[model samples]
Target: MSEPSTYPQPPRRGFVLAVVAAVVLAADVLTKIAVVASLEGEAPVRLLGGAVYLQLVRNPGAAFSMATGMTWVLSLIALSVVVAIIWMAPKLRSIGWAIGLGLVLAGALGNLSDRIFRSPGPMRGHVVDFVSVFAPNGDFFPVFNVADSAIVCGGALIVLLALLGKDYDGRSTKEKAKAGSSEAPAS
Candidate 1:
């Protein structure tokens, strides 16, 4: 048999990561388009026993409308996030990490798309946010979108994994500790 390949193999979970990112990005973009087309000149649509409201709101800033005049800055930050995730994908050997990073990447790309191609020009374009929880016009909570939800969920998963000592490279903190002990210098 041929000698084992010296090249490092691609991440075992890379496929899963790609699929999750694609699905989330598609859903976010589709939902935004649908909401804009349907709700532009209409009243907010209430659903789930008035727990959710669908309305059209274009946000030019970060969460809760912070930095309302800095859409370009927000766009830059989102682009950075996208770049970082893509760079780290090859090291995502854990399924949990892959899924989490995929969600984050999808979210960043979704919002970045808005910033790059939406109204008022590139890098200064507003993000399309439509989902309002509990009340319309963001009375009860800030208006959000599918991308925002994905970001929140993915961030929570990452935090949980970190707390559990699981590394994105498919190793546990405990495993690293054991390996370090084996390589310790003798007294």
Candidate 2:
């Protein structure tokens, strides 16, 4: 009797990754809603003895507020990311890949939600940014939101995984060869 092959394959399910994406998206959306509600008319609320501040601002542009009048283009880009992630979800096997891609999905969907449902118009709305990390002169860093943070972290993780020679299928070359040899019929 022959044993089952040990070769890696596309996972039958990616619910873990989906859950991660859901959590991040929920956090991003909920935080943005809360910040908009609480910090609408109030001054910047400092926390951690001034290390962090919650200052509500609307960004109608890309990172660092660049391309200030091109929000629709940015929304399209985010939508593409969302579509790509959904297409790639079925093949996710490695935990690291799942986490990375999940964060990316979350970030994309989170901001896309804002673009679709927030003020101004559909696909032309501003993203709500409330968290400002550090400021030596009060204007050094770009104010960012949870979705942006997730995207950055997820991208970094993907880069790190690549540098470590990890693949999405979770199988090294040697394992593939062994699995292939084991599946062959003997003379």
Candidate 3:
């Protein structure tokens, strides 16, 4: 009889991940474009009794407006994140991990695309940001957009899954090892 193959097959999770990433990127880009077109050179639009507001802003930095005036450095970091996600996607067997990473990837790519192609020079373009929350003290939260939201959510999910002891494929690593051992042929 022919020997049985031991190599594992590629998981379908990667395809799902890619699709989710694409959707997120598309949504982020579309929303940014809409915000820019609607609120260009306009004042902030108050919403939710001033607890929330829609204001257009351009960020030339990372999250929470950090590293201002370092657009190239931020662009490099974003590009690196996207590359890492793409490289890791195929190896992820867990749907949860794939989903989380996909979201992160999409968000990174969305902002990186803006940095590469938007106004100003390459890798020095500003990211379009909107959606702000206000405190009772009249200070506004840093403006952010869908891409930032996805990135944050994805990062949170990754932490959650790790804390739950789930592997990249959503199975506990111990469980997977036990299952594999059980399936092995006796010598």
Candidate 4:
């Protein structure tokens, strides 16, 4: 009987990535719709004893209300992120990366959709930010939405992976170094 190769193919991960992205996108979109419908003109809904607040905020800017005048630029950046994630999906081999990228993809897509289709015009629309922390109307923490949260979490995960030398190809920096050293010709 033939022995198995030392390296096995990476398990199917694209599906997991796609599913995560789809679920997050759906959730963010649905929640935004619900909030817009119910809290458009109503007062902020305090939850968990003022720890969280929900209201309607059409923010034409980046997270924390930054760059309020660059909605169109933000839209393009988000669109680019979406395209980059989609391009990288087929190459994803690590489950961690899959989830991380999935979250990022969903975030970019969610906000991109809003910036493209929401009020104002195409590529210049405001993002639907309806969640605030500490106080209503972003008194403490800027009002943000699901997309912003996902982006932060996912980006952090990706950065952590990089710092830990974990590659999306399921190899570590040490492993790559060892392989390279072993493959070198004797002097």
Candidate 5:
């Protein structure tokens, strides 16, 4: 009698995720350092004919400048996110999920590091944001950093994958059903 094959093994998704996360984290930290060193309270640099600009802004809240003045609370939240990502990262079987989680992890760590070490008290430090986009009018988009960019891009990818019906274990619903049916005892 022939032995049945077990469930499909997960590809090298975790390794790829780890590499991507490391790159993102390094880029975020390095860019922040360069911005701090070069700008140092200087004015915003205009680019693309006022469509985009780089201005140093310190944010103590979450995305889009919401929840201002809640540094400690946000810090705790970000820490929790990081912990969750680290825990789930090892279990990720889908490349899509791995990439998504990696982005979230990198972003959380990037900001958390700033909150812990960049001036002010612990969990009270401000995140340095510099990239800005403007509308045709004088209105400006919220300033963000490399970490934020990674998080957004990763999130979008994950959402797209989910919409296509990919699961965390990297199996489609039909594939899972087929596997289950094959394992059932004969009538």
Candidate 6:
């Protein structure tokens, strides 16, 4: 047998990431379009005995409607996240990391598109939120969209991976590599 190859492998091309991101972006945009077209002036459509509902709302701020007067700032933050994800994609070799980054990219881009093209103004436009979870009595989770869900899931995945000691480039962690340490010299 030849000597073991010592050359480090290049990172993966992140095709899975690309595919997931594309799917999420398409879904988010299409759903938002449908909601805006059909539910702009309609009442909330309750489902599952009020456990779920569809209510179109425009959010110009972050979670809980915070910073309503700083929509431009939120837009900039979304834009920065998109750019950072793109920048980091090339270095991602693990499927888990790719998936996490892809979801984040999709979420960021989905909201960023609204910020760029929705009403109010460019970079200050409102994000279209629907798909309310739980009751609408202001005692449960805030209304969110598919993109928001993806972001949360993706972020959770990334955190889990980090806790598991996974590397973005898919290399074995140093501690793991040394786990089988042998303090003996070979003849």
Best by TM-score: 4
Error of 2 at 118 (Å): 1.2
User: Which parts of model 1 have CA positions greater than 4 angstroms off?
Assistant: 1-11
Q: Mind giving the per-residue lDDT tens digits that candidate 3 earns over 46-76?
A: 8889887887888888888899889999999
Per-residue accuracy of model 5 over 159-180 as CA lDDT, tens digit each: 8887887876788767777777
lDDT of 2: 0.83
Work out the TM-score per prediction: 0.92, 0.85, 0.84, 0.93, 0.86, 0.86
lDDT of 2 by residue, 39-130 (tens): 99888888888788888888888878898888888998998998888887787788888899899889989888888888898988888988
Who is ahead in TM-score, 3 or 6?
6
List, residue by residue over 3-82, the lDDT tens digit for candidate 6: 34354764695887899999998999999999999988898888999898888989888766788879889888988888
Worst 10 residues of 6 by lDDT: 175-184
Which segments of candidate 4 are over 4 A away from where they belong?
Answer: 1-5
For residue 186, give model 2's deviation from the true position in Å: 20
TM-score of 4: 0.93
Residue 146 lDDT in candidate 3 = 89
Candidate 6: global Cα-lDDT? 0.83
Query: In model 3, where do residues sit more than 4 Å from their true spots?
Result: 1-10, 135-138, 176-187
What digit string (tens of lDDT, one per residue) describes model 4 on residues 47-166? 999999999999999988899989888988888898888888888888988899999999999999998999898988899999999899999999999888889988999999999998
> Roughly what TM-score does model 3 have, to 2 decimal places?
0.84
Each prediction's number of clashing residue pairs: 0, 0, 3, 0, 0, 0
Quote the RMSD, in angstroms, for model 6. Answer: 4.4
